[model samples]
Target chain A: MSFLSVQNIKHSYFTKSTAVAALSDISLEVKEGEFVSFLGPSGCGKTTLLSIISGLIEPTEGRVLLEGQPISLADAKIGYMLQQDYLFPWKTIEENILLGLKLSKRLTEQSKSASLNLLRQIGLIGVETQLPKQLSGGMRQRVALVRTLATEPKLLMLDEPFSALDYQTKLKLEDLISATLKQFNKTAILVTHDISEAISMSDRVLLFSPGPGRLHKVFDIPDVIKNLTPFEARNHELFPEIFQTIWKELESFETFKK
Target chain B: MKPSKNNADLLHKQYVHSLKREKRKVRLYQLLIFLLFFTSWEFSSKMKAIDPLLFSSPSKIIDLLFSKLHDGTLMENLSVTLIETIVGFILGTLLGTLLAAILWWSPMVSKVLDPYLVILNAMPKVALGPILIVGLGPGYASIISMGVIISIIITTIVVYTAFREVDSNFLKVLRIFGASRFQCFWEAILPASFPTIISTLKVNVGLSWVGVIVGEFLVSSKGLGYMITYGFQVFDFTLVWLALLVIAVFATVMYQIVAFIERKIVKE
Candidate 1:
């Protein structure tokens, strides 16, 4: 059995007057410590898929299993980083980082010390006593990443986490996230629109087409891509070749309907 | 010094000198405006351009105020009204906030109560005085009740709307962490709505003061409102004008105090 399994998930939005399907027959299996990316255009239900896996949205027809057993919201071992850095503005940075621990009743002295160390690792040490508003955009996003990591979940879900960042900050954060995930040995599923981001960061990229999104193709990064940071992955000899191939596939998606 | 640095210092000095002169002129104009108003009124009354009996001059109002002060009538009545307003304000804020919380807790209840709260707020509070007097009698209870009735509905509406408008993304953050309903309210909802709550307090200050005075007009004999009623009955027009001036000053001070507290709480 895989570490995480999403089986034949179907979901729809039921407004008062109409039913709109969002996803159909979606299935994926992720191994322990492996990183996967869902690459798609907007409205492809990539975020909805992440939401289902994290137990935030219930799939109308399918189940998510962690280690071959169905996982529910009660067994909250799933960490999710949203598109926005949704840090509580009123809370101090330290208090925000410790929120999940406090909620789950696992906030011990040891966990807090570890969180502080994690803050330092993320280069957010001095802003612990300040509110989220006091930090710049990149710094606030880094603080959010720390807060998600402090919980120590089994599977991490990132929904367009770097989409709101500037190009420079996004590249830096991709590096930081890659390093942190490797250090923690975390299995992660990232949903993103940036094709290069998917190619650089994931073990396997699942491509989806919109209008009731379905997995259209899957690409595995070469073994040579291993152990290289996202930036290094960008510079690999095969990088351009692979990027062009996927770029063609995505472009074909836009032209196929016409 | 470099020539550029010398020029920069001269420019800074000129800017500061102009700013100081402008501020001085503004202050002088403020005093002059008040002086102009009072002097004209006093001059008009002395010349019989306006009758002092009907429209008391500033001097007559001041003299009446001094006599009321010496006799201790002004202070006693002023304090009585102030106490009533403050008590009513506190009670209304607390009860209104509590009701808003309860309503937020259950959408069904809030939906049912929505129309009723609106209607109550729209109803003229003056019309309820006789009914309130009949129920609570002619004392502080009735007066404070009047204040509470006037302020509570609006406070509840303002606070509840604030709670509803709290950013949904913040609540989603807590939900993803498996926060319970109570945790959601305590950590996200209440703190997010704090600025709105303070604004509601400012609005309540005016409403509560109006309530207390209106109640006194209907039934009290020792508060500032009672003094105004008495001045009218005995044809003491100077006493009426003096009491009104005192109420205006008192209300402005109270409003400033609330505003100061708001600044301290919302220090952004």
Candidate 2:
């Protein structure tokens, strides 16, 4: 069985007068320690699908299974990073990072040390006492990632985590997240609009078409070598070929909608 | 090129000079206007243009303030009013915040109690003064009750709104991590709503002071409000003006304290 299975999930929103479908016929399985990117345009339900897989929202039809069992949000084993860092402005960096563990009542001396270690590993050592407002945007996003990772979740869902950042910061964070995910042996599903980002970091890029989004195509990178960084992937010889192909595919979707 | 650089330097210097002159002129104009008002008031009273009995001159008000200080009447009355204000402020804020948390914890309670809270907030608190005195019996209890009654409902409303307005996105982050409702509140809602809560405290500072003063006016043997009521009964307009000045100063000082705490919290 796949480490995480999303089976024929369909979700819709019902207003008092009408129903709006958000997602339909979404089925995929993520292998253990694999990095997958859900690449699509805005309003394509990329985030909705991520939310469903994270167990934050249940689909109207079908279900998600983690390790061949039904997943529950209350299990406390899914780390979902939102588009906004959502770092509590009132909390210090250290406090924010430890929030998950603290909420789960798993905060111990050992867990605290592990969180600090993660912070240091992510080059966020000195600002633990500083509040979220004091940090730069990129630094805040890094702290947010640390906060999610601190709890040692079995799966990580990154929902447009780097979208708020500038180009330079976004690339740097891509490297950081890609490296960190590997170092921790974490399986992750990243939802993003940026094609280069999707290509560089993901082991497989899942292209989603808009309007009640459904999976259109999936591209598995030719090689799955261990420790292949996003920067290295960008520099690969096949990078341009794959980039052009997906870029045209995405542009076609825009025209297709029009 | 060197000469243009020198010209740029000179232009910058001129700009700075003009800016400084403008700032100095503004400050001078403000000070002169304030001084002119006081001077005209004193001149008018001395020249008998306006009745000094009714509109006490700034100097006479100052003199009364000093005499009250020397006699310790101002100090004693000030302390009594301050204690009442502080007690009422603390109790009102704490109870209001707690009740707001309870209301937020259960949406049904919030919905059921919503209209009544609005009615209570809108009701003229002074109208409750006689009722409070009847129930609590004309002492610090009634006085503090007045303050709490005036401030608490507003606090509950403001805090509940803030709590509800806490970013749902942040709450989702906590929920995805398996955080319970209580954890979501403590970690996300409460912290996110902090600026609003502090703003509520600022509002409560004024409301609590007003409540205490109204209570004192209705039924109190001591306090600045009582002094004003007593001064009016004896036709001591100077005493009334002096008490008014003291209350204004005290309220401003209390407001500044709340603003300072707000600044510190926001800065952190």
Candidate 3:
């Protein structure tokens, strides 16, 4: 059985005048400890799929399973990070990081220390008492990552988490997240429009087509690139070859839509 | 590099000096306006340029204030009004916030009562003074109820809007942690709306004063509002002016206190 399985999911948003289908016939599976990327243009319902998999929204049709159980019943096992670091501005960094544990009623001495250790491991030391606004954007995003990991989720979702950061910060965070996820052996699915980001971080890149999004194509990374960090993977000789292949496919979708 | 550092330090000092100078200038202008208004009023009243009995000079108001203070009548009336206003203010804010919370808790209830809230907010609150006095028996109860009634609906609307306006993403974060609805409120919704709540408190201070004073006018038994009515009936405009000035001072003090609390609570 797959660690995470999305089986034939469909979703539609209804307004007073129209019912807009966001996703249709989407089915995929992730093996344990594998990193997958969902790459597509805007309106491809990448986020909609992520939201459904995370159990934040229910698909109009079909279901998601985690470890052979329904996703909704397996709450707190899924961690989702958004494009912006949506840390509570009112809360201190310590409170923000511990929020998940507190909400799950899993806040104990051992867990608290573990979370703080993760914070230190993420290179965000000595910022426990400071408010979110006091930190720079990069520091804040790192803190957000710590908050997500503090829950010790079995599956992680990154919805363009580094899209809002500068290029340098984005590259650094990509390496940090890839290494950390690998260390924990956690299954992760990253949704991104960035081709290089998909090529570098993912074991398999799932390209989605827009306009009632459907799974269009999948690319498997070679072992040479998969063994390297995201930064090194981006610089590998075969990186551009894979990038060109995916880029042309994505461009074809855009042209077909037009 | 050393010379540039010195230059930056010098520029910083000049900026601080200019800021202080601007603040001093503002204070000077405010003091000038106060002095000029009072001095002109006194001069005009003494010179009989304005009707002395109707306009009432600053001197006469002060003399009456002292005598009223000696007899303790001013304090008695002021205390009654202050207590009524304070009680009304607290109750109005609490009940309104509670109502807002209820509305936030259930979307159906808010939808059902939306039109009613709009109607209540638009209607003149003071127009209900006579009914409140008659129902609550022309006492502190009725007067305080007036203060509460006047501000409660608007506070409910403003606070409910604030609660709704909190970013849904914050709730999403909490929801992913398996947070209950109540947990979402306590953890995110309430704290996020503190600035709005504080601002509404500032507005409610003035609102409750209007309500209590109007209630007092209807009841006509005690309070600064009664003092104004009585002074008018007896042609004692000086007493009327005194009540107005006292109300003004107290209202400003209350507003300033709310602002101080806002500064302390909302760091950003």
DockQ for candidate 1, C-alpha atoms = 0.67
True contacts kept of each: 0.58, 0.97, 0.72
Which sections of candidate 2 miss by over 4 Å?
A224-227, A247-258, B1-30
True contacts kept of 1: 0.58
Q: What is the lDDT of residue A125 in candidate 1?
A: 70
Q: Relative to the unseen true structure, what is the C-alpha lDDT of residue B118 in candidate 1, on a scale of 0 to 100?
A: 84
Q: Could you arrange the candidates by DockQ from highest to lowest?
A: 2, 1, 3
Off by over 4 Å in 1: B5-13
Clashing pairs in 3: none
- Global fold similarity of model 3 (TM-score): 0.98
lDDT of 2 by residue, B1-268 (tens): 9999999999999999999999999999999999999899989998889998888888998999899999999999999999999899889988988999999999999999988998998988779899989999999999999988888888988888889888799889889878888888887778777888888888888999999999999999999999999999998888999999899999999999999999998776
Best by lDDT: 3
Which residue pairs collide, candidate 1?
A: none
lDDT of 3: 0.93
Consecutive 10-residue window with the lowest summed lDDT within model 3 chain B? B129-138
